[model samples]
Every structure is written in structure tokens, then in C-alpha cells.
Target: MSILNPLFEAVAWVIMRIHAWLSVPFGASSGWAWGLSIVILVMLMRLVMVPLFVKQVRSQRKMQAHMPQLQELRKRYKGDKQRLNEETMKFYKENGINPLGGCLPLVAQLPVFWALFNVLRAISDWQPGTTPKYGLTIPVVQSAKDARIFGASLADKFLFPLPHQTLESRLVILAFVLVSAATTYLTMRQSQKRGMMQQGPVDPDNPAANMQKYMMYIAPFFALSGLYWQFGLVIYWVTTNVWTLGQQH
Candidate 1:
């Protein structure tokens, strides 16, 4: 089995459970049921990461507060790359500072993100003679395939064509891409605003601070990849981003 099989199974189990719970009211094949399952999954994952998120925010504050020391280290060892690396790590260890801790929430969510992507990809590729992965029954898989959100098939992608997808599907997927990208930008902006408010003006010399600024300008463009991503995965992206905005707000 692939390394991600476990994650796929876990994520798939959650989606199946949510879908089954919603199936009664929304019907077994309702797109809203399936779509909401993905959205809710994102929400659940974020909820579970609350502690990590809080730690990330707190870590950022700590890192910001130590910018002067970090800058001094950088200057002190400007010509010794190896020594700088060693000292930076030593300093972090001494201070209980994990420079990478701020990345925990996003990094933690990556496996689930890719697993959900592959799960939807598997569903999209499922065929009459093919066996389903993730312990999904044929009927359940069929119902999932039939589920539509905003007139777009969850399995469809903007890059897919012709007999495989409808114009409406393309439109809905494009809308999702745009919305995802927009939410991504807003989320970053909101976080930047909060950071500035909490920490005062950003220090340009701080590597972490610089990285944050760079991502604000670059990360939203990644949402455009939704053009090639499954509609269901795009839903996850949009929901996660929207959650970030609301959570940050």
C-alpha cells in the first residue's frame, strides 16, 4: 500500500461518516451533502489544529520579539555560514524557540490535503469494472460520483474536457478557483494585519518575517492550480482558506 493509504483511509472514513449523517436530510446523492462533507472536514481539521495554530501564533510573537538577537547573530557570523547555522540552532535550543513551529498548522494539514486530493482523484477515476479504494462500496462510490455542487461534478476539473465535463462544470470550477484564490489573499492579508497590530512594523532583516511577506505575494497564485485540481479538492482549498480568514478575524 502507498504511504498515504492510511491517511486516505482516515480522511475517507471521516468523509463517509459525514456524508452518511447528512444523507438522510439531503438525500444519499445530494451534492450539498458531499460538498458539505469536504467543507466540514476542513473545519474539523482546523478545529483539531487549534492548539497548534495558537502555538504557531505564539511562536511567531516570540520570534518577532527575538528579532534583535537574531539580527545580531546574523551579523556576528556573517562570513561563517556553517558557524551561523550552528549558532542559530544553538540559540533556538537555548531559548526553547522553534523557528519552524510557526509552520506546524499548515504543515500538519498537508497530509490530509493530499490524501483528500487523491481520494477525490480515485473517485473521479473510478469505473464500472474497477474496484474502489478506501473500503468504499460501489453504491457509495457511485453516489459520490453523482453528487454535484453548484452544478459542478465534484470529480470534474477545469483541465478536463469534452464528454467528461459540461460547460456548467467548468464555470463552477472556475468560480471555485477564483474564490479560492481570493480567499487565500484575504486570509494572508488578514494575518498580516493581525501580525502588524500585535508586533508593530515588521522587521525586514528577520528571515521569518521576510518569508511571510514573500508568501503573501506568492501563495494566492497557487490557488490557480485549481484549474487542474478536482472540484472536490478545490472545495477543500476554498473552505480551508475561508476558515483561516474567519479564524484569524
Candidate 2:
């Protein structure tokens, strides 16, 4: 097994235990309890990473504000790739801006995303006959045969007419996915616009800036594809994205 498998399993175990505890306290089959659990998890993760997010945003703003200086540096160091890199590093150091600061939140979230995926997979694939070889020993496994959240099973139908889909369930999933995609796209667009507005004007001749602009549009499409995977993940992502949107505002 890969090194990450253990970590994934541990997260899954924790999620399961938490779910069990919440179920007991709040009563099983309470959709609110389950939903609240996911929200709480996302909030906790976001709160922990808030410092990183703040640093990233500050660094991005600094970079945007210093674009002119960076451009001048680039022009001065033309034909010297190594020197350009060194100069860029020096600039970041002098300005107290870590070039990698922006990446910290994304990097930190990778494991949480995997953990959520594992937890959702466990919930969707719950069955009684499966031998408990792993650390996932929840006593409610026998009683928790159904993975229905508000009468909708976690199973999804990617095709049209959505087989075995109830009207309410379908609507909930659709709304969740649409909100997820829209919020993600809007948050990214707002961030880009804020950055660009800070930078004054983008250089038409700069391919790098143009490519970054293109990526800002393309990323949401890739992010929205997660709806095809599982609604649980979509819910988690949308919840987090909505939180981010609120925080940014």
C-alpha cells in the first residue's frame, strides 16, 4: 500500500467515529446532524488554515502591487534566466513576501480533501457483511445499512433521467452542484478581478499574465467536475467555497 493509505484510513476512521457520536447525540437519520458534521469539519479545517490563507492573499496583493517593479527587473535581466530567478527571489525576500505563501492553503487542503473522499466513500459503500479488517469499527454499521441523506442515497446518476432518483433528491443534488460550481467560479473571478484591479492594467505583451487569466476561467470547469463523483464531496466543497466567499467579502 502507498504511504498515504494509512493517513486516509485514519481520517476515515475519525470521520466515522465523529458521525457515530453525532448520530447518537442528535439521533440517527437526522440529516441536519450529518450536514452539520460536514460543515463543522470544513469550518475547522478552514479556521486552522486561515493564517496560511491570509499570508497567501497578502503575498498575492504584494505581487500584484509590485508588478511594475517585477516587469522592470525582468527587462533588466533579459537573456539571464538564472539571474532573473535570483533577482525575483531577492525581491520577494526584501519585500517580506514568500512566493510560495499562496500555495500553502492548497497544499494543506490536499489531505483534507482525500480524507473527505474516503469518509464519503465509506458512507456510500456501507454494508453489513464486509469484514472489519481495517480500523473502521463502528457499531452502528449494522444499523446503518442505508446511506440515505434526506431520503436520497449517496449514489448518483451521471446520465439523464437519473435512474432511481426521487424528485426531491434530484433537486437537492442539482441545487448543491449548481451552487458549488457558481460559488467556486464567482469566488475565483472576484479574486482575479481584485488582483487585476490592484495591478492597474495587464500587459497585452505578457504571455504569463494572459495564461494566468485563462487559467482563472478554466479552473472552475475542472472544479465543477467533482459533482460527478459524489454529492457528499460536492456539498463539502460548496460549503467550503461559500465560507471562503463570505470570508473574502
Candidate 3:
């Protein structure tokens, strides 16, 4: 099976049930159900990843505590790049720290993220006059369908008043997109700040630190642009970022 298949099936099952439950009380036209489903999906994923997140945090703390020693080793081996790498790796092994542990939560989450992205994209593509499949039915087999959120159809609108064109949808989308981007940046800033506090000032000349700084700026742009692709997914990411920020604190 594909890496994302399990996550796709799990989210599809849960969200479909949620859609059904909401449909009973508010009817299918009530877009609130869809919104709630997305929120719940994000929550579930975060909960499942919590353990990995905790481990990552612990590993980061250990690495930070050893930063002084690591720096000395770097200076001692500066002229021998390969020896420096070997020494650094040996130190990390002896200390039982995986520097990459800081990224484990995110690495583990990619499959789930893609799964939900595809799921939401499918829902957005559902069309009118088509026999709508019920309860966890995947949307790819069909052609040219449109799904709506409130007055906005998922197919056309990048932000909101949706596809047919309304100022309201456009404003809503813009507002959410800005909020998402800002929140994401704030989250990254907080993480970097905390990491720096724990690890001390990274070597200005360090390639890894420079790469991280570059990502700090570049990532938000990619995240913000995603708002055009699917507003719901943007919300999910924003929510997750907020959660991560809170966890760090």
C-alpha cells in the first residue's frame, strides 16, 4: 500500500462519519459540518504524533546541553572536515542523541498531511448533478464536479465568496490566508528562539544554521501560497502550527 493510504483511509472514514452525523441535524447544505470535520481531523493527527513530539523535545534538550563540547570538537577538527564529521557522529552516538530527532515529528507527519490534502481536494472536486457517493467514497474516479462551502464552491474560489464570485468569500479567504501565514511565522520564530536558548547561539558560519535560517523565511511563503490551493488545508496547517507553538512553550 502507498505510504498515505492508511492515513487517507483513516481520515476519510472519520470525516465521512462526521459529515454524515452533521448532515442528519443540519442537512448536507450546512457547511459547518465540513468545517468541523477538518478541525477534528487535525486534532486527531496531532494527538497521534504527540509521543514522537515528546521524544524529539527530549533529544533536542540533550543535544543542547552538550553544545559546548560539540563546538570544541568542531574547532579541534576544523582543518580535517571528514575527521570532524566522524568525531561529531561518534559524539552524537555516545550521547544517544539524534540531531535529526528535532525533525522526526514533521517527517512522520508528511504522509498524513498528504492524505488529508488529497481527501479535501477530492471533496472540492465533487460536482453537481453527479450521483454523490456516500460515506468515505473517494472522489477521483469521477470527472468535473463542484463542491461548495457555504455560498462558495470549492472549485473556483481561491479564498472565499467562492467560485461564482462574491466579495464575502474573497475577503474570508484572504483573511484566513493572512492569519495562517502570520501564525505559521510566529510558530517558527518561537521554535527557533527556544532552540537557540537551549542550544546557544549557532555558529554564524555553520552551514546547517544558515540553511535553517533560509528555511525560516522560505517556508512561510510556500505555506501562504498553499491557501490558493485549498483553504481548508491551510487551516489545518495553521492549527497544527499553533499547537506546536503551544507545545514548545
Off by over 4 Å in 3: 1-6, 23-27, 127-167, 200-203, 206-211
Global lDDT scores for all candidate models: 0.87, 0.70, 0.68
TM-scores of the models, in the order given: 0.91, 0.79, 0.80
lDDT of 1 by residue, 113-200 (tens): 9999888877877889889998777877899988878888888888955366889999999998999989988888888888788777
Query: What is the C-alpha lDDT profile of model 2 across 1-249, one tens digit per residue?
Result: 557778777765665666777887776556655666667778878998999888888888887777888888888987898998999899988987776877888789879887767655665566667754235664544333345666655444233424567777766777777787788778877877776777767787555688878877787787657647566676678888899888877
**Tens-digit lDDT track of model 3 for 4-114:** 566677766877776667767655545566666667777887898999999998987897788888878978998999999999999999989898998988898787678
Using lDDT as the yardstick, the better of models 1 and 2 is 1
Whose lDDT is higher: candidate 1's or candidate 3's?
1
lDDT of residue 74 for candidate 1: 90
Candidate 1 colliding pairs: none
Kindly give the stretch of ten consecutive residues in candidate 1 with the minimal lDDT sum: 156-165
- lDDT value for model 3: 0.68
lDDT of 2: 0.70
Which clashing pairs does model 2 show? none
User: What is the TM-score (0 to 1) of candidate 2?
Assistant: 0.79
